[model samples]
Target: MSQPVYRYYAGASRTSRSRSAAWSALRWSGSLAVALYLSWLALFPYPSLSGAAADWLGGPIHRALGFAAYIIPLVLISALWRTFKEGRAAGGVIMAAASLASLISGAGVLAVSTHPFGVSPASWGGMLGSWLGEGLATALGGFGAFIACAAVFLLTLQVVLGLRLSVAAAWIAAVAADDFQKWRRSRQELATRMAGAPKGDDAVKDAAPAPAPAPEPVNVIAEKAPSGKGKRQPSRDGGPMPAASKRPGKYALPPLDLLKAPSGAGNTGKPQESEIKSAILALEQTFEDFKIEARVTGYAPGPVITRYEVTPAPGVKVSAFTALEKDIARALKAKGIRIIAPIPGKDAVGIEIPNARPALVVLREVLEGPALPPDAPLLSFAVGLSASGEPLSADLQKMPHLLVAGATNSGKSVFIHSLILSILYRARPDEVKFLLIDPKRLELTFYEGIPHLFDPIVPAEKVTVVTNPKEAASSLSNLVKIMESRYQRFQLYGVRNIDGYNKEADKR
Candidate 1:
């Protein structure tokens, strides 16, 4: 009895698979037939066996599209391929826009190329082409219309094909820079060869064998100048040579490509209208229950938070909402809710609620995007994305001294990580240095021997990353002495600041 039941279940599974395979085959066959028929309609003038049906169907399309009708079959094949491979026929709004642009631009190209008054009335370009093309020709002349349509077509191709302009631009720049460097090297080599080569016939005469000169008398008290080391030289007091000075090599900042690109699908990642409406309704209901009269007027969507503007009715005290902040958060089911009473330069109060899935902010965007100032200092770093979704950059030089006070996992470490990456991507070790003191020790242990640390020549195990309280305090005290010393020098030099003092010293 058990074997019979097992056999029956196996037979049913096989039957289901067979049915699915048959359905898929049929769908593909139908799609192929339709594609081939459409291609024939677009390309050939001959009618099918169903002559009347073909004429009825293809005549209008041919008349409206003319030569541009070829686009229909091409688009259909591409969409069919995408559906077969990726389980989808279309993408987002940009894809739709690209398709429309292709159609219009194709028609415009055909219309402008064909003479308006010459040839048959129903020429290669149909009525739409004739209408669109002749108008553009009349407005901007034939050549201008052709250029405009061609540009639109090219731009549409880029969008539809998902080509990256940045990658192409970078490739071009790299080729040009490499070529320029090679050219400079060739010129320098030629110059050096010319400089060393014999000058006139005198060099040929000097090349002849010559007799050795008589030795000059030596001064017993004179010191011999040092030459290349066949053996290590001793110091002036006959001790072993002091350790050689360690001059740093040219330092290049890490490339921006090392950082990951943003993972957004080119959307703001804002809450849906339905969600916002529901939130507004819940908030209003909560206020009503508390005997307060207020209604949500507007909302600003952001990556991490959505701020809703609330307007209280006349005679309603603002304190009423503040007193029930916790209750309102509970009703909205939102944590870390913030309220701005009578928001500055605004008539309504603002309530900020955290988003469900907060968008991850990447450091690369802050470094490259317009969020940071164009003339920002070398020490400037990205803070984070603001509530309104704008990236914020702050200058450590301007802050001079800043305190990081927050609970564990409140993004203090995350902020520091961004700061380190920002500096690594912007400045070299010689231009700026870090005196990192991680009391936790674990947060900064990985950056132990990095050349950007203050007193980098010292052994990494000794003082690179100060973790002990006593050591950090000692370092700070030493820094104070250095700062006072600089201040005295500035006063003596009659300069107000470091920049001023440096400029004055440069003149000397």
Candidate 2:
């Protein structure tokens, strides 16, 4: 009984497969019949060849295409071939394309081929072709009409062949370019290897061992590393470094490799899961101790701070959170906390605290990031990371004056270095001038005598760092004179700013 049941199921499966096959066959045969009917009509337009169907269908095609009507049947047949090959529900698509191609071919042939009105249908194209051809011929001259027709013909062929000529051309070009590059690289390698090889006579002479030179004297000096709470590991990968240009007077920007990449170890700026849960528990307990009813609904982790959103129970005043800011900081054991009574555009109160893993941003990371515009001026510099870990950059053109002040070991020197380096990466010696006065020599001292420094009251040969108080005063005095002269020039030109002065000077 089980064997009969298995046999019955197999028979049912076969029956279903046969039904699917029959349906597919019916669809394809139906499309094929349409194609054949079109072909017969276009090929044989007389009633004697295909009864009344030829006169009905072929008459219009013949009148439009003249002798070229014969080609219409072949075009339709070719278009339907794809439908049969694909065996998809796209037979209508093929027929539509075939009909379009026939019309376009008639128009194109008429555009190039000239024929008189009321002449034989086989002369050029019939009345339809002559009308379109005359219009094209009058609008564009003889050569233009021919070019248009030829282009249209090629486009129609691609459509009928189910090919995008542009895509196929691009693919072919890419393949050719890849092959050419491979060949050129191989040739270069071969030439380099040949150049490195010793010639027949020199090979023997080079085989002999030479005397070793005396060891050079060595001096090792240890330096103190930057003092920070946590030691940072060196980055694994720096940006790509290009060979520095050697052209004089045309100062190429320094290579990107000079700046350090961000470290990969532990500076994610996000607190651990246990830390967050503990903080939230402490926050609720602290409120409970203060006779306040509030709960942390959600939290947003960022590079420097994590903001916890607190939704108070009904009738719990927002001022309650403000008063407990310092107490909550002590309870959570955080360095500090900022309380926003209600977050902007939201109903919940915001309590922001420092994260455990604070991120250390590098100039290299921001310079390579998308936040900075490509065409920013030389003075445009990376401003470091935002609260949400996004890199920030600023343009100095927008703010001509800036002040950098921080406690010792709080990144003031680092900020100065980043600004100088970012400028060095973009500006040339001739483009912009700088007036740097670093009293401590910790910053701006290293930029001595490499051009881009405005001439001071000192001798041209002695364009070095100004450490002495008197020399610094002289430099500042000279800078003031330069600024006054520039303002005078701006006044003479009836301009207000340096940019306006330059434009006026250029016009003069």
Candidate 3:
């Protein structure tokens, strides 16, 4: 009967409870310390916490924190692997946490590499990049190594931000192309409206004299009024007639015969029908190979480029094709490809390929085409044809300025000559003036004896070019003075623009 001998284990119970409480408190304190330390690092990497904390923790500790931060990605990966093994939902949560950690670490690395923040490479982000360089530099070259590391870091940031580089690039290209086309259309429409409108001087010259109305009989009493008796009653209806307008006699415009007709203009001997069909078939096959559902709806052959319009199957992103532009071009045996994903307003995307046999754009062809109307502005001159094979002309009165530039043997001189010739065909010498600047005298010297010159062409001083520094400077100064005088005149007239001023003068 030993039932009365059983004793309570209270001492053991108290000791176990006390141990648990101490461990819990220690854990909480450790967490709080870590959080506060992180806050301090963020607020001031080199904290001045009354200078005591800084004295206690020296440079080695600071560097250690940086290195530890840089290795966060590795730690996160290990944690993610454990969580995934434990539970699926917990794995997803760990993935999200890891992504955030990677993003922050990657961003820090990028910042240090790009700009000299005076931070040591021992710091978190910088350390990662430095390690990457040590591994990649010998194999990939210094620049390539740096770029490879940058791309890795940037990829992490992009992933977290839910951005795909290919998608973004395609979208930007599409939008830019659409905006450009809209601008061109609006400009062409404006030119059409202006071309059809009558000029003030032209209207006056074209007006016909009105036939005289049947004369009304004057009263005999009024006609026979006594001399000096009463002042003759003035006619209420009729006023003084305007002064008879004088017309400029027949001055001949420059002949269009000066320009040569476009030769071999059409697609005469370019890629044959068989070749085109083969190319189209190849493109379709490539799409099929890539598992992209698309149909080549049609093809348009142009002077320098051939455009193929492709309609992607529903639910297929246009960016898919855009991303495969190089592959498609290679398949088609072409030099390059320009993919306009979802060519604005159309359901189809456009893939422009360079023509196998490109056609030359003849200035004469543009000048002779429908680009110029019978009553086009005096300044209107053809530059080239549009993609639709229509000539494109520009108005100098609208432009008010032009700058021609090209490398040697690039047809800059020929283009300028064509422009000047176009002007001569439309305007009289007095209507427009030219001030040729020939620092490289060879290009503009041929235009010397033309009547449109504002200043007489002077012989070159030394090298058959305006090589004298002082003379060139003086000529430029003179141009500035001329420009200032014109500005002053524009201001004096109370007109906002040259066009408005010209129209006002025409009314008078």
Candidate 4:
């Protein structure tokens, strides 16, 4: 029973294979028929002798003569050529060369046939030879014309068919692209669903949670055993451990003297905001004692501090002020304090204080602020919170250009977004434009519909997508042309940059 089943399955497989082959052959036949029909329309002027003769032969005679005589031999020759060249696949090249040669030969024959010239022999031998030569030439010329006309007809047919094919192919490609996009969206949705599903313990373990805190150590001490009669173990918690007898490789905490004083001065035995204020005032007094003028910049909840922007009196060396950083830190009763003496490009010093309650400055507020003048030279950037926890804004006109570097998740994107939002709020669409190139496809896609956008959100033409170094070089060549044209315009107008040109235009 199994043998019979196996045989039946094998037979079915064979049958299916044969059917597939037959279908492929049918499709090819149809395509060939179409190609030939088109070729015939273009090359109809060229006649086939065999086809002509058969048509002229009497109806009964033609039926007896059969069309197979002309068709069968040509079909056999084509099949044989295809089979022989199947491995190398040079048939297309051969066909193209043959077509070209036929066209040239046809043109030559047409020219010769249209020319009016007759040759007369002077002697008997010459006349006989001339007659034979003339007959041969006429035959060759007729054959050439026939081939040329056929080639032209076929070529014209190919061009028409190719155009139709191209249009059809474009439509198919568009449909396929749409389908692919839909598939991609579906896949993303599926992935998101899977990610949202409850995970197992293994998945939790893979996430690797934060390490557990270490246990605290106890101090122990030992004393010399009674004259070394026998060594005795000391109690674990008796007295202060000798420095040498302490646990190996353990670090000793720093002395309490290094700790900073609480922001307030004169313990009122009751914590009050006045005490915190007094503490800051006391800190400022200390700065005065050092002969350094300091101002209180920020104060908050605990670890209260103040910022001082100071300038040493004239004739005081900046280095002399910086040298007091360690002494200032010690005097302030603070563990850590930074001093920026004679800040870069300025004669003022910057001292920062940690605040008790740092104020939060939302980015939205800055973006909603008043716009800068059209002629304003400065570009502003939001640097993070100062020591006092106040949001800081730096004028870019002073820096000109900034180079920002940070590790991942360092708020780089947020900073950039803030800058863009600020600019958008301050400048009109005509006054500013952005050239955004985000290959990842997400960053600037939101701004695609904005009128200020120059090129399409995504390049529409393949030629514009520079895929190679050579293409980039070609692009640079075009850019050079644009630059040269701009320069010429500048020269003609006797202006400098875009600003000068715009100013002159306004005057005109």
Candidate 5:
């Protein structure tokens, strides 16, 4: 599964860019108000806008306004800084230029009002010459003054806010980057653990070595007993005639030694093969009246135990055999044994005995088995061994999604890896995509090149790996957006599922 990435927004319509723009506007507006108020207080003692008051306060007020004008560019630069920090380089530059323009305009107004001497007097020349010089000079001078002030103000503001913003941004980036790295590391570690874990069936298969080739078929003669009192009759081939005969079931039990209990803490040593064969035969004889099949599947030598697999004949309900569990257990003469009736989807039953020599169930063998269907459900998972040493396969379709929990090295990671491999083998890249969430990093790194992977095994760009649960929840909500979009597309096409919609698109 891949982790989802979340974007913070006030509403769906407010993109990160839009929010930054709004923040810039607010900062500018606030700074402008503060600057204007300070200018007004410095320029005018009274609140009145009368001519006298304008004359008295105009010069000071103009300089104050000019000072305040710097705020526009300061706000703009600050906004730009923020946007740049967020990787919006173009937006920041545009905002900075706009702020600079406001500063220039403010300077023009301030110079004319406060520095009247800078321009030639009206009496110095002809009416047109004096008019042009005074008007042009005042305008130009004021503009220059405002620009200079704005530059100074911008510099000061940058020093203060720049450090803070930069530090904060760096910390955030480092933390986010570390979080992503940790997740990748954890996923890789998990994969390694799973690859090495032992399988259950392996234990059973390792128990008994292959028996020596069977002896050649031999001829045998049976002596017939006297019927009540008559002497037994002989067959024409010179063989003895049997007094009584009976036919056994289709399947025959292997030797009893193959069914002995595993040797370990309880058992003094490995039980002889003869001991296992005799026990199984005796157990079978006890159930002779019923139609049941029992065979030793595995042995563990250290504890000298054996595992027995049992199955009921066709048309025999599992309930019919379950009733004899206690009886069969008693007959086996073992302290404990488990029964799995009607083994999942199979018709056969499963019975486990402690192996006298546990077998090793190789993953390679399981993967190659004919029973492993290519079209097995997508979400099915290979769990570890069952008590009987059979590979435990579980269908994830029932879970819809799984919440795996286990202590470190308890096989959870291995289980996940097996599941991922299994799913990849069964599904094509186009049919299935993974959304991996590896906050621990090591669990999923090896699958980077696997076609089914939706993104790099490691998180990048909008693909996020967050350590915080709250952030993870936010990412999930973002996924909800994706799901919604998909659903909407489905609705437009009158399709109820992803497959249907995809098929419809393909037709076009």
Candidate 6:
């Protein structure tokens, strides 16, 4: 049976994606163009386009651009107004100011005595500012009216932006009063000190103290270590002396290379360049068959999957291609396909197809590749390899807990062993402890006595495994008690969790 499926990237719906794109385009193109045109009008009241192309195309382009100028301000005002209504005070103030200017100028208050920009005032900006300026000049006589209107605009800006001027005014008045009082008091103190000054020679003699002798410097030298024979100490077992002791240091991490290497470990036959090209062609063909417009932009081959990135044409919903997963899979002669519509933080959709020859990510290979940060917590472990073959690791401390469940023979036991081994390679025994509970005794029998255990503190073959249901329940009950104890300690210290508790304990 053919299956058609579509998974929305990061749970974002189509409407949200469209809105985000629209807002971004409008903010960048619309707002910027308007701002620039307005600036040009203010700077050069009369400017001309001079060139052959200008002579041919400039007239029509100029008219179109003039329409754009009016449209840009209107769009900006609408956007700003919407943002302000959404509880953004700054947007409100910006919208109010822009509207005021546009209104006054557009009302025909400022008639262009001369075309400053070599274009008619019928274009877009400067209408409001000119009109407001003319009305103020007629009423209050230029400068007086300009100053009054400026103050009114400033007040309007403050009110629209939700700034309380009363608080600011009061604060300024209080600061001035305090400063005046302090200055007066300081002047009085200065007058008093001048009146009480002693005669010059007597004051100087009294103020000066007798000169003292300088102390002698002491010689210092670095301490020399006791001389020893340049011979290695014999090991306690009477073998040739070991280079380093096996005993764990106070802050020592478990060494790397403790995990086993993969067997038959030659390179897995990943898809060839020809296979990739065919796959891309297959995708394009499938889309064409479905009457959908899409082009495969790129692909990243991962351990078990290859992700093909697809960029759709304008006005095409990514969801359309996503819904054709099964059809595309059939066309490519693949078992199945999965589609990610409009991948997060990217302007493209992703189609993930399973690799023909999947590569296995070995635990040791990841650890040996790069040194983990020295301060990484004991709980950090390699999860797997990412799509681009980068080692992916995760911190169990951040997770705090985990639950692994799967069908029989699903490599669950191997995964658990890898987790335990990863922890053993990083954490010292004193730093972390593990409580292993196994109802199906076969799985955890291998990890019976690895130093990091709590119940089976001393290693013994028969004592560690919990085979019965009752035994497993008892172990779990004890774990609950331990969890409660930890909670009490966390509460006492006013900390949030184990991480917080550990940080506080470390500080002490």
State every prediction's TM-score relative to the real structure: 0.47, 0.46, 0.45, 0.33, 0.33, 0.47
Residue-level lDDT of model 2, residues 93-144, one tens digit each, is: 6556755655655555663555422323344666665665666667776566
Single out the weakest 10-residue window by summed lDDT for candidate 2.
Answer: 228-237
By lDDT, the better pick of 1 and 4 is 1
RMSD of each: 33.0, 31.9, 29.8, 32.5, 31.0, 28.4
* lDDT, each prediction: 0.72, 0.71, 0.61, 0.47, 0.52, 0.61
Provide the clash count, candidate 5: 82
Error of 4 at 140 (Å): 64
Q: Residue 323 lDDT in model 2?
A: 95
Instruction: Show the lowest summed lDDT stretch of 10 residues, model 3.
Output: 238-247
Q: How badly does each model clash, as a count of residue pairs?
A: 0, 0, 0, 8, 82, 6
Q: What are the runs in model 3 whose C-alpha is more than 4 Å off?
A: 1-251, 264-272, 342-344, 397-415, 456-470
Q: Which ten residues in a row have the lowest lDDT in candidate 6?
A: 238-247
RMSD of 1: 33.0
For 61-149, candidate 5 gives per-residue lDDT tens digits of 43334443334435544654565466554344545564444444334334444444563332222232234335656565645544554
Off by over 4 Å in 1: 1-250, 266-269, 456-463, 468-473, 503-508
Per-residue error (Å), model 1, residue 345: 2.4
Q: Whole-model lDDT, candidate 1?
A: 0.72
What TM-score, to 2 decimals, does candidate 1 have?
Answer: 0.47
Regions of model 4 farther than 4 Å from truth: 1-306, 309-337, 343-348, 367-399, 406-411, 428-430, 439-449, 456-488
